[model samples]
Target: MSEWTCAGPSTEPAYDPSDPQSGRALVNYHLRELGIGETHLVRAGEHGLRYCRTLVPEGIGVCRAYVLTEAAWPEGAELCVTVSWSPTAELCRNHTTGAIPTGAVEHWRQRIAATAQALRSVGFVVEPSHVRYSPVYHSDADLVVYRMPEGVPARRAPAAADWALTEPVPPNHQRRSWTYPERSPEDIVIQALRDAGLHAYHYEDPLPSGRVGARSITQTVWPPEADRCTWLTWWPHPTFVRDPGTGLLPDGAAQHWRDSLERIREVLTGAGLTLRTRARPWHPDTDEEVHYLAYRVPRG
Candidate 1:
Protein backbone atom coordinates (compact mmCIF):
# COMPACT_ATOMS: atom_id res chain seq x y z
CA MET A 1 0.00 0.00 0.00
CA SER A 2 1.01 3.63 -0.19
CA GLU A 3 1.56 3.57 3.56
CA TRP A 4 4.05 0.66 3.58
CA THR A 5 5.11 -2.54 1.86
CA CYS A 6 2.79 -5.54 1.49
CA ALA A 7 5.77 -7.93 1.31
CA GLY A 8 8.47 -7.35 3.86
CA PRO A 9 10.57 -9.03 6.55
CA SER A 10 8.09 -10.09 9.26
CA THR A 11 9.26 -8.33 12.41
CA GLU A 12 8.16 -8.11 16.04
CA PRO A 13 6.69 -4.96 17.60
CA ALA A 14 4.90 -4.04 14.40
CA TYR A 15 4.16 -0.40 13.64
CA ASP A 16 0.79 0.99 14.75
CA PRO A 17 -1.62 1.80 11.93
CA SER A 18 -3.36 4.57 13.89
CA ASP A 19 -0.25 6.76 13.99
CA PRO A 20 -0.62 8.46 10.60
CA GLN A 21 2.76 10.20 11.03
CA SER A 22 4.49 6.80 11.09
CA GLY A 23 3.89 6.53 7.30
CA ARG A 24 4.18 2.70 7.64
CA ALA A 25 0.66 1.55 8.47
CA LEU A 26 0.91 -1.47 6.24
CA VAL A 27 3.91 -2.88 8.07
CA ASN A 28 1.65 -4.19 10.79
CA TYR A 29 -1.08 -4.98 8.27
CA HIS A 30 1.39 -7.05 6.23
CA LEU A 31 2.54 -8.92 9.31
CA ARG A 32 -1.02 -9.70 10.45
CA GLU A 33 -2.16 -10.55 6.90
CA LEU A 34 0.69 -12.97 6.13
CA GLY A 35 0.86 -14.35 9.66
CA ILE A 36 -2.75 -15.37 10.10
CA GLY A 37 -2.27 -18.34 12.48
CA GLU A 38 1.36 -18.68 11.22
CA THR A 39 3.92 -16.73 9.23
CA HIS A 40 4.72 -17.32 5.54
CA LEU A 41 7.26 -15.14 3.81
CA VAL A 42 5.26 -12.96 1.42
CA ARG A 43 7.27 -12.50 -1.74
CA ALA A 44 7.34 -8.97 -3.19
CA GLY A 45 4.81 -8.44 -6.08
CA GLU A 46 2.75 -11.43 -4.90
CA HIS A 47 -0.38 -9.24 -5.30
CA GLY A 48 -1.96 -10.36 -1.96
CA LEU A 49 -4.64 -12.63 -3.48
CA ARG A 50 -3.37 -15.91 -2.04
CA TYR A 51 -4.81 -15.17 1.42
CA CYS A 52 -8.38 -15.43 0.15
CA ARG A 53 -8.05 -19.00 -1.10
CA THR A 54 -9.24 -20.47 2.20
CA LEU A 55 -12.68 -18.85 2.01
CA VAL A 56 -15.44 -21.32 1.05
CA PRO A 57 -18.69 -20.27 -0.56
CA GLU A 58 -20.51 -22.90 1.50
CA GLY A 59 -18.48 -22.44 4.63
CA ILE A 60 -20.27 -24.15 7.51
CA GLY A 61 -18.48 -23.23 10.69
CA VAL A 62 -17.89 -20.29 13.01
CA CYS A 63 -16.83 -17.07 11.25
CA ARG A 64 -13.18 -16.20 10.60
CA ALA A 65 -11.51 -12.97 9.48
CA TYR A 66 -9.84 -12.88 6.06
CA VAL A 67 -8.08 -9.89 4.47
CA LEU A 68 -8.53 -9.21 0.75
CA THR A 69 -7.39 -6.49 -1.60
CA GLU A 70 -9.88 -3.80 -2.66
CA ALA A 71 -9.50 -4.35 -6.41
CA ALA A 72 -12.71 -6.15 -7.41
CA TRP A 73 -12.38 -9.01 -4.89
CA PRO A 74 -13.44 -12.61 -5.64
CA GLU A 75 -17.13 -12.38 -6.51
CA GLY A 76 -18.39 -15.17 -4.28
CA ALA A 77 -16.36 -14.11 -1.24
CA GLU A 78 -17.57 -10.56 -0.69
CA LEU A 79 -20.25 -11.37 1.85
CA CYS A 80 -21.69 -8.40 3.74
CA VAL A 81 -19.88 -8.05 7.08
CA THR A 82 -21.44 -8.09 10.59
CA VAL A 83 -19.73 -7.51 13.94
CA SER A 84 -19.66 -9.65 17.08
CA TRP A 85 -20.91 -8.71 20.61
CA SER A 86 -19.41 -7.02 23.55
CA PRO A 87 -18.92 -9.42 26.48
CA THR A 88 -21.27 -9.41 29.47
CA ALA A 89 -20.96 -11.16 32.85
CA GLU A 90 -23.63 -13.76 32.09
CA LEU A 91 -22.20 -14.16 28.57
CA CYS A 92 -18.69 -14.98 29.86
CA ARG A 93 -20.19 -17.27 32.53
CA ASN A 94 -21.86 -19.51 29.94
CA HIS A 95 -18.72 -19.94 27.78
CA THR A 96 -20.75 -18.73 24.76
CA THR A 97 -22.26 -22.15 24.25
CA GLY A 98 -24.95 -22.13 21.52
CA ALA A 99 -25.48 -18.95 19.50
CA ILE A 100 -25.15 -15.47 21.00
CA PRO A 101 -27.44 -12.84 19.46
CA THR A 102 -26.91 -9.09 19.52
CA GLY A 103 -28.32 -6.06 17.71
CA ALA A 104 -24.73 -4.84 17.73
CA VAL A 105 -23.98 -7.21 14.83
CA GLU A 106 -26.22 -5.20 12.51
CA HIS A 107 -25.30 -2.03 14.36
CA TRP A 108 -21.67 -2.28 13.30
CA ARG A 109 -22.60 -3.71 9.90
CA GLN A 110 -24.18 -0.36 8.96
CA ARG A 111 -21.13 1.48 10.28
CA ILE A 112 -18.83 -0.58 8.10
CA ALA A 113 -21.08 -0.05 5.07
CA ALA A 114 -21.06 3.71 5.66
CA THR A 115 -17.28 3.70 5.91
CA ALA A 116 -17.02 1.75 2.64
CA GLN A 117 -19.29 4.27 0.88
CA ALA A 118 -17.12 7.07 2.17
CA LEU A 119 -14.10 5.39 0.57
CA ARG A 120 -15.92 5.19 -2.80
CA SER A 121 -16.76 8.87 -2.53
CA VAL A 122 -13.01 9.62 -2.47
CA GLY A 123 -12.16 7.38 -5.45
CA PHE A 124 -11.31 3.97 -3.98
CA VAL A 125 -12.59 0.47 -4.51
CA VAL A 126 -13.97 -1.15 -1.31
CA GLU A 127 -15.20 -4.72 -1.16
CA PRO A 128 -16.55 -6.40 1.98
CA SER A 129 -16.69 -10.05 3.13
CA HIS A 130 -19.18 -12.35 4.84
CA VAL A 131 -19.72 -13.32 8.52
CA ARG A 132 -22.15 -15.44 10.54
CA TYR A 133 -22.78 -17.22 13.83
CA SER A 134 -22.48 -20.97 14.49
CA PRO A 135 -23.73 -23.44 17.05
CA VAL A 136 -21.66 -23.39 20.26
CA TYR A 137 -19.86 -20.15 19.49
CA HIS A 138 -16.68 -19.72 21.52
CA SER A 139 -15.84 -16.62 23.54
CA ASP A 140 -12.88 -15.64 21.42
CA ALA A 141 -14.53 -15.58 18.00
CA ASP A 142 -13.31 -14.15 14.70
CA LEU A 143 -14.95 -11.24 12.76
CA VAL A 144 -14.46 -9.18 9.58
CA VAL A 145 -14.66 -5.33 9.75
CA TYR A 146 -14.09 -2.59 7.19
CA ARG A 147 -11.38 0.00 7.36
CA MET A 148 -12.19 3.65 8.03
CA PRO A 149 -12.63 5.75 4.91
CA GLU A 150 -9.44 7.77 4.78
CA GLY A 151 -9.08 11.48 3.85
CA VAL A 152 -11.81 12.59 6.27
CA PRO A 153 -11.76 14.75 9.36
CA ALA A 154 -12.19 13.28 12.83
CA ARG A 155 -15.95 12.83 13.31
CA ARG A 156 -18.09 10.35 15.25
CA ALA A 157 -21.37 8.57 14.53
CA PRO A 158 -24.40 8.33 16.82
CA ALA A 159 -25.48 4.96 18.19
CA ALA A 160 -27.41 3.39 21.05
CA ALA A 161 -24.97 1.08 22.91
CA ASP A 162 -26.33 0.11 26.30
CA TRP A 163 -26.98 -3.34 27.82
CA ALA A 164 -28.63 -2.66 31.17
CA LEU A 165 -29.09 -6.03 32.92
CA THR A 166 -31.37 -5.49 35.88
CA GLU A 167 -32.16 -8.06 38.56
CA PRO A 168 -35.03 -10.41 37.71
CA VAL A 169 -37.72 -9.32 40.21
CA PRO A 170 -36.79 -11.47 43.23
CA PRO A 171 -39.83 -13.81 43.23
CA ASN A 172 -39.12 -15.02 39.69
CA HIS A 173 -35.34 -15.40 40.08
CA GLN A 174 -35.18 -19.08 40.84
CA ARG A 175 -33.00 -21.91 39.48
CA ARG A 176 -34.09 -24.98 37.56
CA SER A 177 -34.94 -28.21 39.39
CA TRP A 178 -33.16 -31.55 38.89
CA THR A 179 -36.44 -33.36 38.28
CA TYR A 180 -36.54 -32.23 34.63
CA PRO A 181 -33.71 -33.22 32.27
CA GLU A 182 -31.25 -31.00 30.36
CA ARG A 183 -31.21 -27.20 29.90
CA SER A 184 -34.19 -26.26 27.77
CA PRO A 185 -33.95 -24.32 24.51
CA GLU A 186 -36.08 -21.56 26.08
CA ASP A 187 -33.36 -21.00 28.64
CA ILE A 188 -30.84 -20.54 25.86
CA VAL A 189 -33.30 -18.35 23.97
CA ILE A 190 -33.67 -15.92 26.86
CA GLN A 191 -29.91 -15.55 27.12
CA ALA A 192 -29.57 -14.94 23.38
CA LEU A 193 -32.39 -12.38 23.42
CA ARG A 194 -30.83 -10.49 26.32
CA ASP A 195 -27.50 -10.40 24.48
CA ALA A 196 -29.43 -8.99 21.53
CA GLY A 197 -30.42 -6.04 23.81
CA LEU A 198 -34.03 -7.03 24.56
CA HIS A 199 -35.36 -7.21 28.11
CA ALA A 200 -36.68 -10.74 28.75
CA TYR A 201 -37.69 -12.31 32.08
CA HIS A 202 -38.98 -15.57 33.57
CA TYR A 203 -42.07 -15.43 35.79
CA GLU A 204 -43.11 -18.36 37.97
CA ASP A 205 -46.68 -18.97 39.05
CA PRO A 206 -47.00 -18.77 42.82
CA LEU A 207 -48.46 -21.54 45.00
CA PRO A 208 -52.14 -21.80 45.96
CA SER A 209 -51.51 -20.43 49.46
CA GLY A 210 -49.60 -17.40 48.09
CA ARG A 211 -46.27 -18.99 49.00
CA VAL A 212 -43.00 -19.21 47.07
CA GLY A 213 -42.88 -22.69 45.59
CA ALA A 214 -40.15 -24.68 43.93
CA ARG A 215 -39.20 -23.25 40.53
CA SER A 216 -41.29 -24.95 37.86
CA ILE A 217 -41.04 -22.52 34.94
CA THR A 218 -43.54 -23.57 32.29
CA GLN A 219 -43.18 -21.11 29.39
CA THR A 220 -43.31 -18.09 31.76
CA VAL A 221 -41.76 -15.69 29.19
CA TRP A 222 -44.55 -13.18 28.60
CA PRO A 223 -43.03 -9.75 28.17
CA PRO A 224 -44.93 -7.19 30.26
CA GLU A 225 -44.70 -4.68 27.42
CA ALA A 226 -46.53 -7.03 25.07
CA ASP A 227 -48.89 -8.80 27.48
CA ARG A 228 -50.28 -5.52 28.80
CA CYS A 229 -52.92 -7.17 30.96
CA THR A 230 -51.77 -6.80 34.59
CA TRP A 231 -54.19 -9.13 36.34
CA LEU A 232 -54.81 -12.82 35.76
CA THR A 233 -57.47 -15.37 36.75
CA TRP A 234 -56.90 -18.19 39.27
CA TRP A 235 -56.04 -20.20 36.21
CA PRO A 236 -52.78 -19.06 34.56
CA HIS A 237 -54.57 -16.81 32.08
CA PRO A 238 -55.31 -13.10 31.92
CA THR A 239 -58.70 -11.73 33.03
CA PHE A 240 -60.16 -10.47 29.76
CA VAL A 241 -60.41 -6.71 30.35
CA ARG A 242 -62.99 -4.84 28.30
CA ASP A 243 -65.01 -1.67 28.65
CA PRO A 244 -68.69 -2.21 29.50
CA GLY A 245 -69.63 0.40 26.91
CA THR A 246 -67.40 -0.68 24.01
CA GLY A 247 -66.09 -4.22 23.23
CA LEU A 248 -62.64 -2.75 22.71
CA LEU A 249 -59.97 -3.65 25.32
CA PRO A 250 -59.49 -1.09 28.08
CA ASP A 251 -57.06 1.85 27.63
CA GLY A 252 -55.98 0.72 24.13
CA ALA A 253 -52.78 -0.75 25.66
CA ALA A 254 -52.72 -3.98 23.66
CA GLN A 255 -51.81 -1.92 20.62
CA HIS A 256 -48.56 -0.93 22.33
CA TRP A 257 -48.06 -4.60 23.17
CA ARG A 258 -48.40 -5.50 19.50
CA ASP A 259 -45.79 -2.89 18.62
CA SER A 260 -43.35 -4.41 21.12
CA LEU A 261 -43.93 -7.88 19.66
CA GLU A 262 -43.05 -6.64 16.16
CA ARG A 263 -39.81 -5.08 17.43
CA ILE A 264 -38.88 -8.31 19.25
CA ARG A 265 -39.57 -10.33 16.09
CA GLU A 266 -37.09 -8.26 14.13
CA VAL A 267 -34.36 -8.85 16.73
CA LEU A 268 -35.02 -12.61 16.88
CA THR A 269 -34.99 -13.17 13.10
CA GLY A 270 -31.82 -11.09 12.74
CA ALA A 271 -30.13 -13.56 15.11
CA GLY A 272 -31.31 -16.52 13.01
CA LEU A 273 -33.88 -17.69 15.54
CA THR A 274 -37.47 -18.54 14.65
CA LEU A 275 -40.31 -16.65 16.34
CA ARG A 276 -43.99 -17.58 16.12
CA THR A 277 -47.05 -15.70 17.39
CA ARG A 278 -50.54 -16.98 18.17
CA ALA A 279 -53.80 -15.70 19.62
CA ARG A 280 -55.93 -18.11 21.62
CA PRO A 281 -59.03 -17.82 23.82
CA TRP A 282 -58.45 -18.68 27.51
CA HIS A 283 -61.69 -18.29 29.43
CA PRO A 284 -64.08 -20.85 30.92
CA ASP A 285 -67.19 -18.63 30.67
CA THR A 286 -66.65 -16.76 27.39
CA ASP A 287 -64.24 -16.66 24.49
CA GLU A 288 -61.51 -14.22 25.55
CA GLU A 289 -58.36 -13.90 23.45
CA VAL A 290 -54.69 -13.57 24.45
CA HIS A 291 -51.72 -13.00 22.18
CA TYR A 292 -48.35 -14.65 22.74
CA LEU A 293 -45.08 -15.09 20.85
CA ALA A 294 -42.73 -18.05 21.13
CA TYR A 295 -39.12 -18.72 20.15
CA ARG A 296 -38.64 -21.98 18.27
CA VAL A 297 -35.63 -23.93 16.98
CA PRO A 298 -36.09 -26.04 13.89
CA ARG A 299 -36.82 -29.65 14.78
CA GLY A 300 -33.51 -31.42 14.11
Candidate 2:
Protein backbone atom coordinates (compact mmCIF):
# COMPACT_ATOMS: atom_id res chain seq x y z
CA MET A 1 0.00 0.00 0.00
CA SER A 2 3.02 2.29 -0.25
CA GLU A 3 3.59 4.78 -3.05
CA TRP A 4 6.82 3.10 -4.12
CA THR A 5 6.88 0.77 -7.21
CA CYS A 6 9.68 -1.27 -8.74
CA ALA A 7 9.08 -3.26 -11.92
CA GLY A 8 10.98 -6.43 -12.87
CA PRO A 9 10.44 -8.39 -16.06
CA SER A 10 7.38 -10.65 -16.15
CA THR A 11 9.80 -13.57 -16.77
CA GLU A 12 6.90 -15.92 -17.27
CA PRO A 13 7.94 -18.02 -20.24
CA ALA A 14 4.34 -17.59 -21.26
CA TYR A 15 4.38 -13.82 -20.83
CA ASP A 16 4.45 -11.94 -24.08
CA PRO A 17 5.44 -8.29 -23.82
CA SER A 18 3.49 -7.46 -26.98
CA ASP A 19 0.44 -8.40 -24.94
CA PRO A 20 1.49 -7.51 -21.42
CA GLN A 21 -0.59 -8.68 -18.47
CA SER A 22 -0.47 -7.74 -14.78
CA GLY A 23 -2.53 -8.66 -11.73
CA ARG A 24 -2.29 -10.97 -8.72
CA ALA A 25 -0.64 -13.71 -10.76
CA LEU A 26 2.45 -11.58 -11.36
CA VAL A 27 2.59 -10.94 -7.61
CA ASN A 28 2.78 -14.67 -6.99
CA TYR A 29 5.50 -14.95 -9.61
CA HIS A 30 7.51 -12.34 -7.73
CA LEU A 31 6.95 -13.85 -4.28
CA ARG A 32 8.24 -17.18 -5.56
CA GLU A 33 11.14 -15.44 -7.24
CA LEU A 34 12.05 -13.87 -3.90
CA GLY A 35 11.63 -17.21 -2.10
CA ILE A 36 9.16 -15.66 0.37
CA GLY A 37 5.52 -16.33 1.18
CA GLU A 38 3.55 -13.57 2.91
CA THR A 39 -0.02 -12.67 2.05
CA HIS A 40 0.99 -9.03 2.60
CA LEU A 41 4.44 -7.75 3.45
CA VAL A 42 5.58 -4.92 5.70
CA ARG A 43 9.22 -5.40 4.73
CA ALA A 44 11.55 -8.15 3.59
CA GLY A 45 14.91 -8.92 5.20
CA GLU A 46 16.64 -5.86 6.74
CA HIS A 47 16.77 -4.04 3.37
CA GLY A 48 13.61 -4.43 1.26
CA LEU A 49 12.00 -6.17 -1.73
CA ARG A 50 9.08 -4.91 -3.83
CA TYR A 51 5.50 -6.10 -3.36
CA CYS A 52 1.99 -4.65 -3.50
CA ARG A 53 -1.63 -5.74 -3.44
CA THR A 54 -2.82 -5.21 -6.96
CA LEU A 55 -5.56 -5.71 -9.48
CA VAL A 56 -2.39 -7.07 -10.99
CA PRO A 57 1.26 -6.88 -9.93
CA GLU A 58 3.16 -5.25 -12.76
CA GLY A 59 6.16 -5.53 -10.48
CA ILE A 60 5.00 -2.73 -8.23
CA GLY A 61 6.73 -3.18 -4.90
CA VAL A 62 4.78 -3.21 -1.69
CA CYS A 63 5.85 -1.07 1.22
CA ARG A 64 9.41 0.03 0.41
CA ALA A 65 10.69 -3.28 -0.95
CA TYR A 66 11.98 -4.19 -4.40
CA VAL A 67 10.34 -6.77 -6.68
CA LEU A 68 12.37 -9.80 -7.74
CA THR A 69 12.40 -10.27 -11.48
CA GLU A 70 14.02 -12.83 -13.85
CA ALA A 71 17.10 -13.93 -11.89
CA ALA A 72 20.00 -11.70 -13.02
CA TRP A 73 21.13 -11.91 -16.62
CA PRO A 74 24.61 -10.72 -17.51
CA GLU A 75 24.68 -7.19 -18.94
CA GLY A 76 20.94 -7.45 -19.26
CA ALA A 77 18.45 -4.78 -18.28
CA GLU A 78 17.92 -6.56 -14.97
CA LEU A 79 21.57 -6.25 -14.08
CA CYS A 80 21.55 -2.51 -14.60
CA VAL A 81 20.05 -1.16 -11.41
CA THR A 82 19.70 2.53 -10.69
CA VAL A 83 20.27 3.91 -7.17
CA SER A 84 18.78 7.30 -6.41
CA TRP A 85 19.64 9.52 -3.48
CA SER A 86 16.71 11.40 -2.04
CA PRO A 87 16.90 15.14 -2.37
CA THR A 88 17.94 17.30 0.57
CA ALA A 89 15.22 17.77 3.24
CA GLU A 90 15.52 21.55 3.04
CA LEU A 91 13.96 21.39 -0.42
CA CYS A 92 11.44 18.58 0.06
CA ARG A 93 9.89 19.20 3.54
CA ASN A 94 6.44 19.77 2.06
CA HIS A 95 3.49 17.43 2.70
CA THR A 96 3.22 16.70 -1.02
CA THR A 97 6.56 14.94 -0.56
CA GLY A 98 7.60 12.14 1.78
CA ALA A 99 11.22 13.17 1.69
CA ILE A 100 11.79 11.65 5.16
CA PRO A 101 15.12 13.41 4.80
CA THR A 102 16.78 10.53 2.95
CA GLY A 103 19.03 10.84 6.03
CA ALA A 104 22.66 12.18 5.80
CA VAL A 105 25.18 11.27 3.08
CA GLU A 106 26.35 8.37 5.21
CA HIS A 107 22.81 7.16 5.35
CA TRP A 108 22.78 6.80 1.57
CA ARG A 109 26.21 5.20 1.74
CA GLN A 110 24.82 2.71 4.26
CA ARG A 111 21.86 2.22 1.97
CA ILE A 112 24.22 1.29 -0.86
CA ALA A 113 26.24 -0.96 1.40
CA ALA A 114 23.20 -2.62 2.88
CA THR A 115 21.58 -3.05 -0.53
CA ALA A 116 24.77 -4.54 -1.97
CA GLN A 117 25.05 -6.92 0.97
CA ALA A 118 21.45 -8.02 0.64
CA LEU A 119 21.82 -8.65 -3.08
CA ARG A 120 25.02 -10.60 -2.55
CA SER A 121 23.26 -12.59 0.12
CA VAL A 122 20.73 -13.54 -2.50
CA GLY A 123 23.43 -14.26 -5.11
CA PHE A 124 23.50 -10.93 -6.95
CA VAL A 125 26.92 -9.36 -7.52
CA VAL A 126 27.61 -5.62 -7.53
CA GLU A 127 28.84 -5.15 -11.05
CA PRO A 128 29.49 -1.65 -12.40
CA SER A 129 26.32 0.43 -12.75
CA HIS A 130 25.31 4.06 -13.07
CA VAL A 131 24.05 6.25 -10.22
CA ARG A 132 21.80 9.32 -10.36
CA TYR A 133 19.56 11.33 -8.04
CA SER A 134 16.93 13.97 -8.31
CA PRO A 135 15.13 16.33 -5.96
CA VAL A 136 13.24 13.08 -4.96
CA TYR A 137 11.86 9.64 -5.66
CA HIS A 138 12.20 6.71 -8.15
CA SER A 139 8.61 6.18 -7.58
CA ASP A 140 9.75 4.04 -10.54
CA ALA A 141 12.18 1.13 -11.29
CA ASP A 142 12.27 -0.75 -14.57
CA LEU A 143 13.56 -4.38 -14.43
CA VAL A 144 15.10 -6.73 -16.95
CA VAL A 145 16.44 -10.31 -17.16
CA TYR A 146 19.79 -10.81 -15.35
CA ARG A 147 22.54 -13.37 -15.93
CA MET A 148 23.62 -15.66 -13.11
CA PRO A 149 27.27 -15.98 -12.12
CA GLU A 150 29.46 -18.75 -13.57
CA GLY A 151 30.44 -20.68 -10.42
CA VAL A 152 27.07 -20.58 -8.68
CA PRO A 153 23.87 -21.95 -10.15
CA ALA A 154 20.70 -19.83 -10.24
CA ARG A 155 17.64 -20.72 -8.18
CA ARG A 156 14.98 -22.96 -9.69
CA ALA A 157 12.72 -21.06 -12.06
CA PRO A 158 9.27 -20.64 -10.53
CA ALA A 159 6.09 -20.71 -12.53
CA ALA A 160 3.10 -18.48 -11.80
CA ALA A 161 0.73 -21.34 -12.61
CA ASP A 162 2.40 -23.61 -10.02
CA TRP A 163 2.26 -20.94 -7.34
CA ALA A 164 -1.41 -20.16 -8.04
CA LEU A 165 -2.36 -23.76 -7.13
CA THR A 166 -1.12 -23.24 -3.55
CA GLU A 167 -2.60 -19.72 -3.38
CA PRO A 168 -6.27 -19.42 -4.32
CA VAL A 169 -6.92 -17.02 -7.15
CA PRO A 170 -9.43 -14.39 -6.15
CA PRO A 171 -12.56 -13.99 -8.23
CA ASN A 172 -11.84 -11.64 -11.11
CA HIS A 173 -13.02 -8.05 -10.65
CA GLN A 174 -12.33 -4.58 -11.96
CA ARG A 175 -11.77 -1.37 -9.97
CA ARG A 176 -13.29 1.08 -12.38
CA SER A 177 -13.69 3.63 -9.60
CA TRP A 178 -13.93 7.38 -10.11
CA THR A 179 -14.02 10.51 -7.93
CA TYR A 180 -13.53 14.05 -9.11
CA PRO A 181 -14.21 17.68 -8.28
CA GLU A 182 -17.72 18.75 -9.24
CA ARG A 183 -16.84 20.82 -12.24
CA SER A 184 -16.66 21.06 -15.96
CA PRO A 185 -14.50 18.59 -17.94
CA GLU A 186 -14.23 16.36 -14.87
CA ASP A 187 -17.86 15.37 -15.17
CA ILE A 188 -17.28 14.76 -18.84
CA VAL A 189 -13.87 13.21 -18.14
CA ILE A 190 -15.32 10.65 -15.74
CA GLN A 191 -17.27 9.06 -18.55
CA ALA A 192 -14.07 8.46 -20.52
CA LEU A 193 -12.25 7.06 -17.49
CA ARG A 194 -15.04 4.59 -16.86
CA ASP A 195 -15.01 3.67 -20.50
CA ALA A 196 -11.27 3.08 -20.37
CA GLY A 197 -11.66 0.78 -17.33
CA LEU A 198 -9.35 2.95 -15.29
CA HIS A 199 -9.88 4.47 -11.84
CA ALA A 200 -9.96 8.17 -11.00
CA TYR A 201 -9.07 9.27 -7.48
CA HIS A 202 -8.50 12.81 -6.24
CA TYR A 203 -4.86 13.83 -5.76
CA GLU A 204 -3.31 16.97 -4.35
CA ASP A 205 -0.11 18.11 -5.95
CA PRO A 206 2.25 19.81 -3.58
CA LEU A 207 1.31 23.43 -3.29
CA PRO A 208 3.46 25.42 -5.62
CA SER A 209 6.87 26.10 -4.16
CA GLY A 210 7.87 29.75 -4.01
CA ARG A 211 9.54 29.53 -7.37
CA VAL A 212 8.57 31.94 -10.12
CA GLY A 213 5.46 30.68 -11.99
CA ALA A 214 4.96 27.55 -9.92
CA ARG A 215 1.41 26.25 -10.18
CA SER A 216 -0.16 23.41 -8.22
CA ILE A 217 -3.70 22.29 -7.59
CA THR A 218 -5.90 19.47 -6.34
CA GLN A 219 -6.31 17.11 -9.30
CA THR A 220 -7.36 13.58 -10.18
CA VAL A 221 -4.92 11.03 -11.63
CA TRP A 222 -5.33 7.50 -12.89
CA PRO A 223 -3.48 4.23 -12.29
CA PRO A 224 -0.10 4.46 -10.55
CA GLU A 225 0.95 7.78 -12.06
CA ALA A 226 1.51 10.34 -9.31
CA ASP A 227 1.96 14.08 -9.77
CA ARG A 228 0.49 16.44 -12.39
CA CYS A 229 -2.39 15.51 -14.60
CA THR A 230 -2.62 16.71 -18.17
CA TRP A 231 -6.41 16.99 -18.36
CA LEU A 232 -7.39 19.45 -15.60
CA THR A 233 -4.22 21.53 -15.71
CA TRP A 234 -4.81 22.22 -19.39
CA TRP A 235 -8.21 23.57 -18.46
CA PRO A 236 -7.97 27.33 -19.09
CA HIS A 237 -5.68 26.53 -22.10
CA PRO A 238 -2.63 24.54 -23.28
CA THR A 239 -2.46 21.41 -25.47
CA PHE A 240 0.76 19.41 -25.64
CA VAL A 241 2.56 17.11 -28.13
CA ARG A 242 5.53 16.53 -30.39
CA ASP A 243 6.57 19.17 -32.91
CA PRO A 244 6.17 19.55 -36.72
CA GLY A 245 2.78 21.20 -36.05
CA THR A 246 0.48 18.27 -36.56
CA GLY A 247 -1.81 15.92 -34.61
CA LEU A 248 0.61 13.05 -34.79
CA LEU A 249 2.04 10.65 -32.21
CA PRO A 250 4.94 8.24 -32.52
CA ASP A 251 4.44 4.70 -31.27
CA GLY A 252 5.19 3.29 -27.78
CA ALA A 253 5.07 5.51 -24.64
CA ALA A 254 4.43 8.81 -26.37
CA GLN A 255 1.42 7.47 -28.16
CA HIS A 256 0.17 5.92 -24.93
CA TRP A 257 0.19 9.26 -23.06
CA ARG A 258 -1.43 11.01 -25.99
CA ASP A 259 -4.05 8.30 -26.25
CA SER A 260 -4.89 8.71 -22.56
CA LEU A 261 -4.98 12.47 -22.96
CA GLU A 262 -7.17 12.19 -26.01
CA ARG A 263 -9.71 10.12 -24.04
CA ILE A 264 -10.42 13.16 -21.87
CA ARG A 265 -10.16 15.42 -24.88
CA GLU A 266 -12.92 13.81 -26.96
CA VAL A 267 -15.20 13.92 -23.93
CA LEU A 268 -14.54 17.61 -23.25
CA THR A 269 -15.06 18.59 -26.84
CA GLY A 270 -18.26 16.58 -26.84
CA ALA A 271 -19.30 18.57 -23.75
CA GLY A 272 -18.60 21.76 -25.71
CA LEU A 273 -15.21 23.12 -24.55
CA THR A 274 -13.72 23.44 -28.00
CA LEU A 275 -9.97 22.82 -28.24
CA ARG A 276 -7.96 25.74 -29.63
CA THR A 277 -4.27 26.13 -30.25
CA ARG A 278 -2.25 29.11 -31.37
CA ALA A 279 1.45 28.75 -30.59
CA ARG A 280 3.92 26.25 -29.26
CA PRO A 281 7.23 27.21 -27.67
CA TRP A 282 10.47 25.76 -28.94
CA HIS A 283 11.89 23.09 -26.67
CA PRO A 284 13.63 24.85 -23.76
CA ASP A 285 16.76 22.81 -24.26
CA THR A 286 16.60 21.01 -27.61
CA ASP A 287 14.72 23.82 -29.36
CA GLU A 288 12.46 21.32 -31.06
CA GLU A 289 8.82 22.40 -31.39
CA VAL A 290 6.83 20.50 -28.75
CA HIS A 291 3.41 22.00 -28.06
CA TYR A 292 0.66 21.65 -25.52
CA LEU A 293 -3.02 21.61 -26.43
CA ALA A 294 -5.04 24.77 -25.84
CA TYR A 295 -8.75 25.01 -25.49
CA ARG A 296 -11.47 27.62 -24.98
CA VAL A 297 -13.46 27.03 -21.82
CA PRO A 298 -17.15 27.73 -22.07
CA ARG A 299 -18.34 31.18 -20.97
CA GLY A 300 -20.36 31.29 -17.81
Best by the TM-score measure: 2
Give a tens-digit lDDT track for model 2, residues 136-216: 323221222233436655444433232212211111111122334423333444454345443224333211110011122
Listed per candidate, the RMSD to the true structure in angstroms reads: 21.2, 20.2
How large an RMSD does model 2 have?
20.2
* Each prediction's TM-score versus the true structure: 0.22, 0.24
Query: How many clashes in candidate 2?
Result: 22
Question: lDDT tens string, model 1, 136-198?
Answer: 222332233333435532222212121111222211213323224434444444455566555
Candidate 1 residues lying further than 4 Å off, grouped into runs, are: 1-183, 196-248, 278-300
lDDT at position 99, candidate 1: 38
Q: What is the lDDT of residue 247 in candidate 1?
A: 61
Error of 2 at 156 (Å): 26
